[model samples]
Target: MGESTAPILRVNQLNKQFGTGCRQCNEVGSRQLDKNYCTACGTVHACQQISFDLYPGEVLGIVGESGSGKSTLMRCLYFDQEVTNGEAFLTPYKDGSSNLFEESSQQQRYIRNHLMGKVYQNPVMGLRMDFSSIGNIAEKMIAAGNRHVAAMESRGSELLEKVHIPLHRMKEAPKNFSGGMQQRVQIAKAMSNNPPILLLDEVTTGLDLSVQANVLDLIKHLQRELNISIVLVSHDLGVIRMLADRTMVMLDGQIVEQGLTDQILEDPQHAYTQQLVHSML
Candidate 1:
């Protein structure tokens, strides 16, 4: 992605916190908290002034340890968790003039169905285990107002095949599939709407090493073939290295470093990021 290319998605000053803010924690620039939490107020700032731009046909990786707010950030973007405050603009929605966070729930639903797709870390969160793999894909299509059964079936089958899910088992529920296979089904379902943006939160976590590679490879292939923009969140730097063109390092609910993947790997500036890079070596 070039600097001149307008961002497909832009997020500004995003914040998500739990618990009511006390005066000590609400002092803004003067507040001092332990990491991202306030002992005095018992408020956990999951994400703080998080901002970034995702360009078209690019993969922007967010890497951080657990509790560093990477997953929280993803959840906020997907509207799984309501943000305390933020503004996100999507070029495809309202000409990028409206803040998505301020949109009505109905409009957000439309955006989720037509403009973006998300594959959660846990398959249970993304898929209805009781529904057939094809049926899961059909559910998303239905949300997008797709009414043609024949078209949905054809699209579902095509997507499942693209993700390497066998057509023979398309009618089987995800509960019967292996962890990796279930993840693949989730990916297929997320892509069912042919959305421009895909949000993947730890999609390969908990799988065997071999399975991880397969799922990652499938994602890379799909991104190239479809030219879709992706915001990929993972704790594993290796995964980020393999797929992300640009990378952001988050620590304590803030972005500590961000740049091209190669530069960050070769010469990390932040102590936390350096530690993360060294551990991957």
Candidate 2:
């Protein structure tokens, strides 16, 4: 199954809405929402009928301006936010028959610990700022069922080294680290479980240009080394260009265009996508 051409992850008609389904909100069709918001019912149609596939060892990029629902889509996939409606499947879960969104909380927690890794745009969202760097990674391993302290400690040390975090700081809290370092630690913690799919949301958003380059390089290297399927969300085209194998351009909570990254950049088909491409030039 590892070498099968089937996608590692599949999503269908995913939707996330933040409001009561009042008559007023129901009257505002998804197509009519302005910038993902409905004026009539004050509803935020964060993600509307989003659908996509992520293949093994593929870097699938989701790009959109703020409020375009890219981040909302990620949050939904990671179960950070509940999906109002949709189906998500992991190839390895119940032999691909189970819908992730419908799983029990216990089952969802297990899957989150053992099957997926998520890195948030903000370190505070991903890391325990008050905990030692080693502690952060250990928390993941613990969730994955590691009971031996010595083994977890050793694993944490090794992952920290892998992410280029200095060993001397293993006992230091991440609150004292720079933004780049905090992100590295977050990556290390996310990878601790060795999940087959990684969800990264704006991992390089606020870092220095040089730091962003280094982080991007590290991601590429790890993708090759681990062969993990990656879902990367970013508004930055350059980041998408540098990493994604395929790109999806989103607008107003809809996928305006999607294709090979180069094709999307060089021959955008949608008006919104064309505008994005032209602005990048």
Q: Which lDDT value does model 2 have at 195?
A: 97
The whole-model C-alpha lDDT of candidate 1 against the native structure comes to 0.95
| Every model's TM-score | 0.99, 0.95
Global fold similarity of model 1 (TM-score): 0.99
* Model 1 spans with C-alpha error above 4 angstroms: none
- lDDT of residue 245 for candidate 1: 97
lDDT tens digits, residue span 1-281, model 2: 36659998999989889986556555535345557777777888887778999998999999999989999898888888889999999998897889999999888899899999999999999999999999999999999899999999999999898889999999999999999999999999999989999999999999999999988898899999999999999999999999999999988788888999999999999988889889999
**Most lDDT-accurate candidate:** 1
Q: Which stretches of candidate 2 lie over 4 Å from their true place?
A: 1-4, 22-31
List lDDT for all candidates, in order: 0.95, 0.91
Best by TM-score: 1
